[model samples]
Target chain A: MRAFLIFTVFLAAASAEHCYKEIEKACDPTSNKADSTPINCNAKYGAIDGVQSALQKYVNDHIERSFEYLLMSTHYANYEKSREGFEKLFRGFSDSKWNTAIDLIKYITKRGGQMRFPEIDSEISSNEDYEMYELQSLAKSLDIEKTLAVEAHNIHGLAARRRNEFHDPEISSFIEEKFVHKQADDIRALSGHVADLTKLLDGRDSSLSLYLFDEYLQKL
Target chain B: MKSVVLATVFLTCVVFASAQLQCAQKKPNIPTDWIDMASPCVKKMRGQIQEELKASMQYLAMGAYFSRDTVNRPGFAKMFFQSASEERDHAIKLISYLLMRGELTRDISHMIKKNLVVPKTEWATGVEALKDALNLEATVTKKIRDVIKTCEDPKDSSNFNDYHLVDYLTGDFLEEQYHGQKEIASKISNLDKLMDKHGALGEFLFDKKISGGE
Candidate 1:
């Protein structure tokens, strides 16, 4: 019984750690466009000279980004909503959801449209109101922000140029209200949620439970 | 004796040659602090969230005691205890996560205790606190991703078995995002309706809604 149990354990271990070669074989994409690399699918580490060593960084990077996306989605949503409510209550702003719309647009431009920008753009553009008009104009400037925000072959020059891009009062005000100030609060809230979920997920096993927690509560 | 010695040397040479071939095939730097990089940051982040949840739990508990709603007072107290327990569980899990990663956990008890200052009256304050929690999950999700990246960087190959740490962390991160993205946000978005629907039962659900319905 003992020998059988030990053998079973070994078999389980073997199957569980069935390295990249096996993963690669199982997950062949149909088109040649399927670019499979170590970054895409590999156990982050393997034993090297009996020492554990990780070969790739993509998994970690993706996981981190996924969390960041969750944070941005939540906090920015709340911050924009709160700001809208607050502005309506305090600042006498006509559109309560203006900052949120603008914030989403800026996020899409900067972070590659994680929350469906085209749909958002149409939504903003189609809204026949003065606030929508102002936000629509802001959306047009996203191209310039993208341009001035990035540069080929130089980080410092790009920073300097982007600084010039925001030299305009309208752009500066939009950024300050929607992105910069709002981002700080969003970031704080995101950090708190990250902490909570990290603690919860780290403890639990079973993907099903994790999935449920994520689906209903965490909202990742 | 001579034959045995020769056989041993031959076996050693074969093993050495195989290992050499493997190493020479892929030259990825193994970092010493890789595990530390992944673990310490995660631990730190987990500590912060645990603290917030703990504080929120205490606040709710205190709020329940103070609120004049006698019908749900006992229920709310029960919910508060459950929340505190869950937060404690989270703290333990954070510690376990650190241990699994072969990293030491910094003492976060004091920090958590200090932050546990919730309002005594949470009839409405609890709702606000829950909103804060929803927002908190969003923030933590971002930092956890950074920790995963830091761990996976080709440069730092720490000694702790990072074999599936990536998958584990990835799974955890996805779960985190889901919890925040779907569940809490929905609750906060529909807070007014939820409050109106359950009445007394709503107080219990609002106070104690576990992620997995557990």
Candidate 2:
């Protein structure tokens, strides 16, 4: 019994040491952390040029969208009745985009890539998005959602195809694990809103039904 | 038929014009609110939210400064970035509270463009940055107290004194401010003592003790 307990303790220690080495291997391309067996950080995990640029571009895109949503959220919040609903919707989108961008930023550094985010001008409103009513703005937001979903899908395909040359499956796995489904979820929710709103008004933009819809949206 | 064609053109033009101007609701759209939280109190909260956001942007600037190639102190960079994120979270929490109280908030996202102007990017040293952070925490603490006072107004007819908001700000925001101030102060003093003995090298080594670390 004592021998079995000792064996278990030894196993735990070995596993812990292996985990530490794995993370240590994650950091530097110079030297392996383990004395027992060395792993190449750069050769194993370094993103190819194409993949790195794609990820960087994707991050930049998300950052732009995040700022765009921030503007839209504030624009919606200015209205009288639908303020609560549209504020929650657009602000939630902005938060999600910011989070994904930050995560991708960290992941880029992990893969030994430097980011070059172009300074975005905060003046995003060239169109009349500011004056868009609840249903109209929602329609626009749905379009944004569709674009994001399509982009995520395209990137997933790109990452998968690129993994044939280099062993960097992590990028594909990340998009698959983190983004693809989330984008789908966002699209589903936004599309639902668009359909409901369009049907609620029955092709009319101005109606009492819009106010009624606002109350329902506030609950969400 | 001539009259019908002219009417069709007129109707099309009318639709185009109204599409641009139709955002203005024809009917009254009065918002519903269960809570009696005064607009003054709500406005104060929003103002404080802007203050928190400004501080966040300032911390982000400090983080950027420390991360620069000429002044590469990853420890300080990491610390300031953490503070930036924390300040942002504080603003988010306050905003969430406002939403929960059923108080409507105006579009304050314009503050992003207004508040992100960081005039002094380069500090003399990490020590100077630490002092600035300490001072910032003190100022934010004072602001939080002012918010509490506004919320705790006895003369307001609501008579609830915005007790929940006061309790929340006192408990959560002020606690974080005090703890952060104390930590920054200790870091500054300890570094001062170290620098007196060993100068620049001491400051370098002192920065290595990064609670908000790489």
Candidate 3:
């Protein structure tokens, strides 16, 4: 009985090795097995290409947001009156956006995807309107948040679509749980903050209101 | 045992035969219009490269001005010449990046045909030259920023942004611009302080200090 068990184990191991060798032969083009069948991975290749292209575009969006925030920071820094609080806020946002871009690139590379760096235009026209009141700047900030939320949604949709098409459960869960849901939560929280700030500033131009808002943002 | 071994070999051959299908596809030719070299942002970058070259020429002219027998400021001449080389290097870097991205036109002769405005060849004083150089650096910084801005999506309603291009610009160029401006500003401040202390004698002392490689 002991000899029989040992022989069974040996036979299984040999069979598995033979299967691995067959897979290796399929991968090699120069192998002269006339009767050998090929396994087409064209569908997988197409899926990868599609996802990579979308991810590249997504990366570009993140970079644009970062640059926009950077310009906003510069405006606050260089302005004669100088709102240091707003400058810090914009700078913080810019850093976050930049990091997000890096994170996305890392994720793509981890998945064996090639990254193509796109050319970017970094000028911000909104920065030219920096002379506007604190309320207006906040409005602009809200607009940025809204745009980011939309982007997050679009990315989520792409990931979900790819998952459905390719039946990639890992990518689906990763996109939905890690990115989509998180972005949605962020959008909700940001919207609430923007609304509260808008309400607080309604019919008020006092330095006190501005100071309070700045303080609130600093805490956030 | 021999029967088991023969059966395994037979299974492996059968599996290989059943799995056979052509995996290799003909290599697709790349489309000529695949890369958008004439995109507004790319065109702006190309123009900025020319601006870099022009800046290099201006620096060279400044170096020549300081090297004149009448000027007799070897240190200033050396500094300006180095600045010129740095600017030329910046232009070359931009060109190389563009080429890597297939954004630059293949026609090298067309790239050579630049309508660069000739830079002023003379400065009334060292202070004047320093101020001009500082201003030029600031302008170049602004131009670089503009290139970055051009990468942004113009359609306000859309969230599409060019992250890759911005990354390249910020990573490769902007830090250097900031540092260059800061250095020039410091030099200007020092020159101003020196002028305040000595008047005509300050200029004489400043020249001597610079010429001594200080």
TM-score of chain A of each: 0.24, 0.72, 0.67
Off by over 4 Å in 1: A1-220, B1-77, B105-129, B153-163, B173-177, B188-191, B194-214
Worst 10-residue stretch by lDDT in candidate 2 chain A?
A37-46
Our tally of clashes for model 3 stands at: 21
- Predicted candidate 3 versus true structure: per-residue lDDT over A42-148, tens digit per residue: 11322444466777667656656655565465444432324577767777776676557655655554554543444332234432443344556556776877776
Question: Which fraction of the native contacts appears in each prediction?
Answer: 0.00, 0.04, 0.00
lDDT of 2 by residue, A1-220 (tens): 9999999999878755764666565566675546534332232233455576777678767756765676567555543443667777788888887667666755665555545544443444434334466777887788887887788777667767745554356777887888878778877887898778766655335466676677777788
- Output the worst ten-in-a-row residue range by lDDT, candidate 1 chain A: A49-58
Model 2: CA > 4 A from native: A1-45, A48-50, A53-57, A60-64, A70-79, A115-122, A125-128, A153-167, A203-208, A218-220, B1-24, B27-82, B90-111, B114-179, B188-214
Which tens-of-lDDT digit does each residue in A1-220 have in candidate 1? 9999999999878656665544565567752434443332322121211111110111112222222222222221221112122222111111112223323322222321111111111111222222111112123223322332232112222222344331223323433454444435434543454444344434323233333433443232
**Candidates sorted by lDDT, best first:** 2, 3, 1
Cα lDDT tens digits, model 1, B33-120, are 5444444445544554545444434433442342223223333344344444444444444444554554432322122222233333
Model 3 agreement with the true structure over B1-214: per-residue lDDT tens digits: 9999999999998777545422222333566654543367667777887788678757756765665544556677778867866886686577556655555432232333222334487788888999999999989989989988877653344343667778888987999988878887887788888788675676777777776766
Question: Which regions of candidate 3 deviate over 4 angstroms?
Answer: A1-46, A119-132, A162-167, B1-214
Better of 1 and 3 by lDDT: 3
Q: Worst 10-residue stretch by lDDT in candidate 1 chain B?
A: B19-28
- Best candidate according to TM-score: 2
